[model samples]
Target: MPESATLPSATTKLEYLRKDLEDLRYYLDEFSAFLPLSVIIVNPQGFILDINQAFENLIGLEKAGVLGSTVAKLFCEQEQFAELEARVLKGEVIKGARATLLLRDRQISRSLYLSPRHDCEKNIIGYFLGIYDISENVKLTEGRNGTVCARTIELEEKSEDLLRSRAALMNILEDVAEEQKKVEQERDKTLAIIKNLADGILIFDPHNVLTLINPQAKEMMQLDESSVVGKMAAALTKVTNIMPLINFLGRNIKKVYRKQLELKSDKVLEISAFPFLTGRETLGKMVILHDITREKAIETMKTEFVSVAAHQLRTPLTTVKWSLHLLLHGNLGAITAEQRDLLMRTDEHNERLIGLVNYLLDVARIEQGRFVLRNKNVDFIKLAETVIAPFLEVSKNKQLNFKFIKPREKVLPVNVDEEKMVLVIENLVDNAVNYTPPHGNVTVSLSFDKAKSEVLFTVKDTGIGIPEDNKQRIFTKFYRAENAAMASTSGSGLGLFITKNIIEGHGGRIWFESIQSKGSTFSFTLPLK
Candidate 1:
């Protein structure tokens, strides 16, 4: 029985040894299949015992090459190996400590998870180490940081663009608000003017809707202001046929003045339609009507008087002009120098009177719609020089500087009535020189821009400028600045009025800039072809 028991014990010990070897093989196979992760086994003395395929790949060395090597040999720094050894000695699991492993060509950084292994007696036996290659993750994480930084910079640029857009929008809104205020003020003034005028005034929208009617208009139409305020013209004037009035408003013409409309009450009314405009926008229409029954009779009587007076006055003026011309030209006979001088003086005074009469006639012709412009290609530079030559001589007498600045190139030619443009410049320069103090400067200039298709002629003078209070009224007929009147009494105050008419007739624009005691610049633009 003792011999049989010995035999069974020996077989059982052999079976236990085989099973332990098989388990070890299974663990080694499982660890080898783990990709991108390395498995390492070390003895208690920190010498490498076994390594998997991933371990060889991570350390850039073969398994056979690394086995039996001390752990300190793989670490580039001996200090890292010392730390791992201390953890192994303490029988503690050390996790996730990164170290650089040195190779011949490159240094590889690795993360290691080391754990202590012990026997049943609690004696330190070995260590299991797992290593991960973290170089790619490090590079990928740095790239991600760069991407985040770039995105932050892009967002900052977008924020600045949005801020600039907001500021531009605010400026546009402010400008619009300021323009709206000015419009409101002008509207109030126009309404006040309409109310105070003796002639009846009515305003209508494009839809033929009555927007406003002055008190005089309401009374003239024999209707209450409240009743006609929002009502249509057809409704208000139903008792009187208003077809002509409606047709006048609907006409394609921009402006039509002195349209006669006979009412049901047998009243003769003269209606004038003036289209109100804002830039290119047409706001609405304004109609002013005069009860011309009485005025028409008075006007007819005055027309007869003016014609009779002109006819009666022309013969005497003609005779006097011929008589002076004959004497001054020595046409009648040879005469003494003193007699000739006296005759020349009389001729000059008669010529001045004739010029005054001609000015009056021109104003009358313009008012009668008989004045017209003959537009032609005219060089403004030559025109300016010619007009200022006589004035320059006079300027020399006053010890003033008269200068002309012509364009370098031909610039652009203006289609204008040459006679009218010369007269316009002559009037402006004459006014400047007349008001200017002695030793002051007068400059005439012509400039043009082809892109805008416009030509600008300017007459600038160091003169007694118009005060702000009188600036607006300076263009009105017979209206002169206070200082201008005090400085020079010879002006008829019609130069600017006539110049404005001439420019408007040629489809041009005119304006002036001035300051009190700082002089003035009068500029006008002609369309260039």
Candidate 2:
């Protein structure tokens, strides 16, 4: 009914394909019937399908009469046909084998080639045989007692051609040998890496069939070498802590997933997996299993000590902050201007120290899995407005124009920890405002991405953007970009790190785009319910 629907469909394509196939078969039959050298086509079951005119001439038979006959039953030696069948059907190409064909009244010696034809699935469907007349060259004999005459120049030319061929073949063989040596060396290096590795090695083929298990993996699993290969990797679930094989295969995780797994009683393995990719294919995963019980114990001890120390220092720090605030605000008594300025500076420095301590405590809580979220369904734009207000006043003092683009759909709700979400937005806007120069602008926006089913938050700043070297480590704690360090000296560098943790805890994603000396934009997305 539509103009575009008038084009050819599946039936049209099928008819075109039939026509092409018919033309191809006709051309092939003509070429084979006229060719001088003998050629034979046969089915996998060894029955002859067709033959060339040369083959029919040699055999003194009409091919149309013996189309379904077996080549081994006539026209060739029985022993050789059986040997050829065994070799060719197994996918080996046998070339230049000396075979004698039984002609009408005599035997003809020729060089034979037998090769199997396969379908896309690599199953043998038929065989192709080519016979070359090599009896003239093989029957030639050298002159008796090395004598030569002027009439022997053709034979001398043939000898020289043979010598050149021999030299060329030797060069090819040497090249092949060198290539083989390099391959062998590389193979040995890979095997050494696998066998001597502290972790296990499991290699699966493109078809998801396990093909290799090294000595280290065998030892770790206490498995017999013979039973592992040629099977699926699903067996790992029985003796190791890997997920069920279904989740493990074809998952291009793009990052290393580390897990502390108990393979058996008293056995602890730290497993890390990355989707093993080469060229363009995801192929499979490479998993490393390490014994990290001792490392875990050391980390646990370190975390406990820091937690205890932070709790002890919190009381004194709170007292200092409160005392400084009272003195600066004249709550205790009237103070001289200079004394107030001194107290104000002290209060600012004290706040910086307090922020650092809080960041450290938060990091510890995250590491210990003690950072808990109280999720509530809250209006998303209202949350953004509340956080954006403080940054507006802060930026105005520095002459940076602050902007907040409210979402068109202003009533979207998201389930999140309200306090933690505020921390994320505050850190982003604070960083943007702090980094931008006077008269520069900072913008924050909220929007719903219907395709991803997520609410997007973006912070754009006309600031001295992150340098190339520091961009990779921007989210790492205590890592400040060179430009950022040059522009300001007061930041703790823990904001983005904390922001990343909070966002991921909310099942969100965060990333940024920046160019040095130009500007930067940080974007994050949270799910909208």
Highest lDDT scorer: 2
Give per-residue CA lDDT, model 1, range 279-331, as digits (tens).
56676788888998877667556645654565566678778999988877878
lDDT of 2 by residue, 161-273 (tens): 54453333333333334454576699999878887887777766555556677777666656776765676655544534333332443333223467666544455666676
lDDT per model, in order? 0.74, 0.75
Per-residue lDDT of 193 in model 1? 91
C-alpha TM-score for every candidate: 0.49, 0.63
lDDT of 2: 0.75
Show the lowest summed lDDT stretch of 10 residues, model 2.
Answer: 245-254
Could you say which candidate leads in TM-score?
2
Question: CA RMSD for every model?
Answer: 31.9, 20.6
Q: Evaluate model 1: give its lDDT.
A: 0.74
Off by over 4 Å in 1: 1-315
Model 1 misses residue 17 by how many Å? 99
